[model samples]
Target: MTIRILLDTDIGPDCDDVGAVAVLHALEKLGEVRIAGMTHCTSSQWGAGCLDALNRFYGRGDIPIGTLTMPGFLDGDSGYAKYNKGITLGYPNRYQTEPAPDAVETMRKVLAEGEDGETVIVAIGPLINVMNLLESEGDLYSPLNGMQLVSAKVSMLIAMGGHFPAGKEWNFEMHPASAAYVVAKWPTPIVFSGFEIGAPIHTGRSLTADLPDTHPLRKAYEWYVGEGETRHSWDLTAVLYAARGHHPFWELESGTATVDAQTGANDWKHNPNGNHAYLKAITSPSLVAEVLDNLMTR
Candidate 1:
């Protein structure tokens, strides 16, 4: 059965987000998933633009793209201006317009529209949007917010956040409070594609070399790979794991997660208290190469 997926992403930090979208499109083609909606959680002017560009590239422009209201940070600077400054670097023409709809509201609408227990949330960015949903609607969705939500409204929350062994990672670090809130309060099963899993799967080379510049994916990839360097496929791993349960590069484990209240680090231990999937990294260079090749070709 095809899983209904709501993709929450932060596309501008690195170009691999583009590749992640490509992988999602491929999964849709394979009939393994459906694109319910997309929420951009970077809380930047360019965040929405990045989402729009990717959706347009994949011929999914009609997909609802919502922007977060929370601010974003830079490499190490957790300031609003850092995100605003980064916006100047990509698709300047698109940022001059008004922002898209509120991401939190869009998420609520999507959840309302989904059939009971049928939606899967694949979060490949900051946890702000999901956190907002949980905090605002937790009481009303007590049954559908925690483990019950996991079994009912949500099949799984495949998140590309946190780090293995509970260290700092950008996504989790950016809004550590929100991350902690969502993981602790969420009522569903979560599968984390942390930095340990995605950081290693770097793209070897451009797969769009043969395609003309006019090709949407090709143009997006070209623009993304500005410095003639292969990008890291951080978000794509989450996409792959979500669409195809086995990637030959990840070992899955059932564990309970404990969130550090002060720091956003997540500690996972084997337990029955919560049903969360922690991904352990494995060697799968071949699988990465094959997926990259197929995405570029298709």
Candidate 2:
């Protein structure tokens, strides 16, 4: 019953993506997940390196990471890379170099290496990689093209961007065309961790009180948004559901989620034929916070 996960994230700017990675590793440690690979849609040179440090901190430095090296593809620096240097000062790692294999190929390679219908794609970033994955043709990994390959291997899509019922968010805003395209034609069932879903579940405050100063997550959070402030838990919610799937936590709402191509706004419509669903708040934010902090702290 081990779940294979291909995580796609825009990690540096927001510390939640870091938190999402933490939870992924924690669950992996518990034998609930096997991280297949990580793909970064962010354009920062330091972004991939930061994730490498975290994975290494959790004893999984060998995990494959994909990066978007092309210019203007939501490229920029995440100030949180400042804390990553701390991890490298004491450990050896290969994340500092420019990312290789490119994101699309890296994902294809990850999927190709996995068993059919076992890999789950969890995206907590922009839709850049999703668009590319679907539009891409067959490569050295498999004879199947992008959509076909995904339909064959990946079980579902769990994304962490968008405000339900027609509102714009950062991930969708960055690439509306891609967002719209992905929601409309992606082959598997999709579930969203909406803005409202995780908006109330504040985190980071607990780490400040419980974790040691040497802890990388504590340091990452401290450097990213100061010592006391708590941020919303949007990305973390997606990671939880991706592994647990509304189990002891959430109630699932069935429907199709749509994005406006021009504005990146989203709306949900019920269709038995639709392969989409969005999270409906079930368990309280406090319970979610407790579960997330417990996993992240471990």
Candidate 3:
């Protein structure tokens, strides 16, 4: 059976996000998963545009794309706005555009209509959308929290957020309150792809080099890769794990993650809460290289 997936991404900040989307498209072609929706949680307008471009590139333009009402981080001008302008200038009408919807409504509708036990939520951005969904419409659904929603409607949540033993990841830090709420209350199995996972997997190398100039993935990468050259593929790793189930380098653990109220540190414990899945560590280099190579070529 194909896994139905909802991809929540903040695509533009780093080039790896585009790479992640590319990888996801490849997985869809292989029939490993069916993308139910794509939501953007970043402040980058360019990111949203990039996502639209990507969906159109793969001939999946009908896939719904939702943007966050507010930006997650404050990096100069909003990333979402910047991305929007950039992508509009670059691709023009290469993709469709839609206003951001109520995320809770979108998730509820998607999960309700999807095949039971075949859905997975792969989050590569902040937990705002998921958190909002839980806060507003969670009780209406079977699961009262994001975690519970996962356990009930999803097979698993392969998230590209949070740091494992350490606690300084950008996604977690961007919205600590939401992260705390989610990690503590979510019910389904979770596999966390953290900052460390992407460290060894650097971009601006083989993946871009191998792609032809007309390739959409290459165009997206070219826009984001600047300065120091290589960028982290944080989101792509989560996508890989979700599509492939197991990569050679990742080590999984069943545990509950508790966010420190003061420091925002995520402390994962092996208590039998029956509501957590923690990715303790990853075999960074091989997994990153393998995923990137596969995405660039395929």
Highest TM-score scorer: 2
Per-residue alpha-carbon lDDT of model 3 for 81-122, expressed as tens digits? 434455545663333354555456667667766766778888
Which of 1 and 3 is ahead in lDDT? 1
Model 3's alpha-carbon lDDT is 0.68
- Candidate 1: residue pairs that collide: 117-152, 145-187, 146-187, 146-188, 147-187, 150-188
**Stronger candidate by lDDT (1 vs 2):** 2
What ranking of all candidate models by lDDT puts the best one first?
Answer: 2, 1, 3
The local distance difference test score of each candidate is 0.70, 0.83, 0.68
TM-score of each: 0.83, 0.94, 0.85
Model 3 reaches what TM-score against the true structure? Answer: 0.85
Off by over 4 Å in 3: 43-46, 71-84, 92-98, 138-151, 261-263, 271-274, 280-284
Give the distance in Å from residue 181's predicted Cα in candidate 1 to where it truly belongs: 1.1
Off by over 4 Å in 2: 76-92
- lDDT digits (tens) for residues 94-147 of candidate 2: 766545458898999999999889899999988889889999899899989999
Model 1 has an lDDT value of 0.70
* True-structure Cα RMSD, model 1: 4.1
Poorly placed runs, candidate 1 (over 4 Å): 71-96, 137-152, 214-228
Top candidate (lDDT): 2
